[model samples]
Target: MSHKGCCYDNAVSESFFSSLKRELLIDTSQHSAQQAKTAIFEYIEIFYNKQRRHSTINYCIPELFDSSFS
Candidate 1:
């Protein structure tokens, strides 16, 4: 969390949700809560965190970008 009344507090989260809606939820429909949970988990862990290239990190996979620091 950031300081009170900070405008940038939700910037990262908002961007992430926007991408998630556009990339994963636009075409897919989940029948149940469990199914939605599973789909979101896979989208984040398998695709977003691993396979997708992020422009913010020089078009690198987020996992790879994190690994480079270690």
Candidate 2:
């Protein structure tokens, strides 16, 4: 858990949610809760984890980073 008022402790999570809002949520409207849930799932599993390049990982996709350990 992050310490109270320590922004650095939550920087990674903050960055992720910021990207999610910017990339997927802004200007898009979902018809239902389930629809929003599905969209978020796809964004995380298919795009964010499998396709998007993260600078912290030297611009490698998260799937590639995981595979390197196998």
Candidate 3:
């Protein structure tokens, strides 16, 4: 948690949501809550964490980056 009124506290979360909105959610049409949840889960677990390369980590997949730390 961050101190009240601190914008930087949510910057990383905001960036992630922005990417989610632009990448997966934008192209998808979910007719039910379950569908939306499933799509979000797959997007984060499969695509975002495993397949997608992040520039911040020198274009490496997030799962690989995390495994390196572990």
Candidate 4:
């Protein structure tokens, strides 16, 4: 689908990466690509996509997200 006018298309992806970098990359102990990848995977799968709630999701987590529309 064309996302030319859809902020929703890019918004969550950006927010997720920002949170991951802020929480993982800025940590002085994370010094390697492997460490960064592990941290990001954990953050995305465990935190962002599962436990952490989002205001945009009407405070629901990803498992509760609707797929009927964008």
Candidate 2 lDDT tens digits, 1-70: 8679686988888899999999999958999999999999999999998899999899998888999999
- Can you list the residue pairs that collide in candidate 3? none
CA RMSD per model (angstroms) = 3.3, 2.6, 3.0, 6.1
- In terms of lDDT, the best-performing candidate is 2
Give the Cα lDDT of each candidate.
0.91, 0.92, 0.91, 0.75
Compared with the true structure, model 4 gives a TM-score of 0.57
Task: Score candidate 3 by TM-score against the native.
Answer: 0.77
Q: Could you give candidate 3's per-residue lDDT for residues 2-62 as a string of tens digits?
A: 7896868888888899899999898999999999999999999989878899989999988
TM-score against truth, every candidate: 0.77, 0.77, 0.77, 0.57
lDDT of 4 by residue, 1-70 (tens): 9667576788877777687778766874767989867877887778877877788878887666855355
Cα lDDT of model 1 by residue, 20-60, tens digit: 99999988999999999999999999999899999899999
* Cα deviation of 35, candidate 1, in Å: 0.4
Shift in Å, residue 27, candidate 3: 0.6
Off by over 4 Å in 2: 1-6, 66-70
Quality of model 4 by C-alpha lDDT: 0.75
Model 3: lDDT equals 0.91
- What's the lDDT for candidate 2? 0.92
- The reply for model 1, stretches above 4 Å from the true place, is 1-7, 66-70
